[model samples]
Target: MKTLTLLMTMSLLLAFVWERVDMVRLGYRIERLKSDKVRLERERDELRVKVSSLTSPARIAKVATEKLGMVPPRQDQVVVVRLEPEAPSPTSLAEFEIKLAKHDVSRKVR
Candidate 1:
């Protein structure tokens, strides 16, 4: 009976120790993930700033003029394109309503 009790006590102690070790391991993992998330977020913000600078109109214009040797268009060199307004749709609501009214009136007359 004494040996059995000792065995039970040892088993319970080992279980407790194992659980504590697992908890510590999980805590370290959580810390590592948090740091990684922060680092990635910082990198994303830096990349966003870089993209904005690279795509800015002023930067683009400067690069075009300096690297590509592009020149601004003179007044006569520029061409303006005008888009004509589209005609109203054939099946407009007003036309549909007029047709519907005429059909109703003719039916009533009949």
Candidate 2:
């Protein structure tokens, strides 16, 4: 009976040791994940700053003038065309399709 009791005690001790080891491993994993999250958050902040700088109007205008040789249009160079609405509303699908087909043909000719 003593031998059986000793065996049970040893089994319990082994199970307790295994549980402690697993707990320590999980703790290490959680720490590593926390550090990774912090690093990713820092990287995200850096990227946000970079995007803000790159998208600023001053930076865009500088790059356009220096790299692309772009110039702003002068008042005399701008021309505006006023569009007139001439098409009557279609009452049926067939009428719409016919009008769409005519528009497509006219566009293709141009």
Candidate 3:
């Protein structure tokens, strides 16, 4: 009976050691995952900075003028337009005013 108890005690000790080893392995994996996460986050931050730089105003203007062949409007080619308030009775005068306003806004945006 004593030998049997000794063997049982030995088994329990071995089981405890095994559990400790598994816990240590899992801890290592967790640490590795944390390291990977940090690396990925850093890379993402770098990419975001790069994207912002590429989309900057100067870069966009350069691309627009050089790549797309866009140019500023000439003064003679430009016309002023205004928007007239809506009236219950629409008149050609009011419609003309509205058209002018829309053209003005469009020119300003460009």
Runs of candidate 3 with Cα error greater than 4 angstroms are: 73-110
TM-score of 2: 0.68
The ten-residue window of minimal lDDT in model 1 covers 96-105
Answer with 1 or 3, whichever has the higher lDDT.
Answer: 3
Give the per-residue lDDT digits (tens) of candidate 3, residues 1-110.
Answer: 99999999999999999999999999999999999999999999999999999999999999888887666656655666766667646444644531211133354323
The TM-scores of all predictions, comma-separated, are: 0.66, 0.68, 0.62
- Model 2: per-residue Cα lDDT over 1-110, one tens digit each: 99999999999999999999999999999999999999999999999999999999999999988887666755555555544436655652323211111122222221
Off by over 4 Å in 2: 79-110
Deviation in angstroms for 60 in model 2?
Answer: 0.4
Q: What pairs collide in candidate 2?
A: none
Cα lDDT of model 1 by residue, 1-110, tens digit: 99999999999999999999999999999999999999999999999999999999999999888887665655555455544435666564332211111122222221
Sorted by TM-score, highest first, which candidate order results?
A: 2, 1, 3
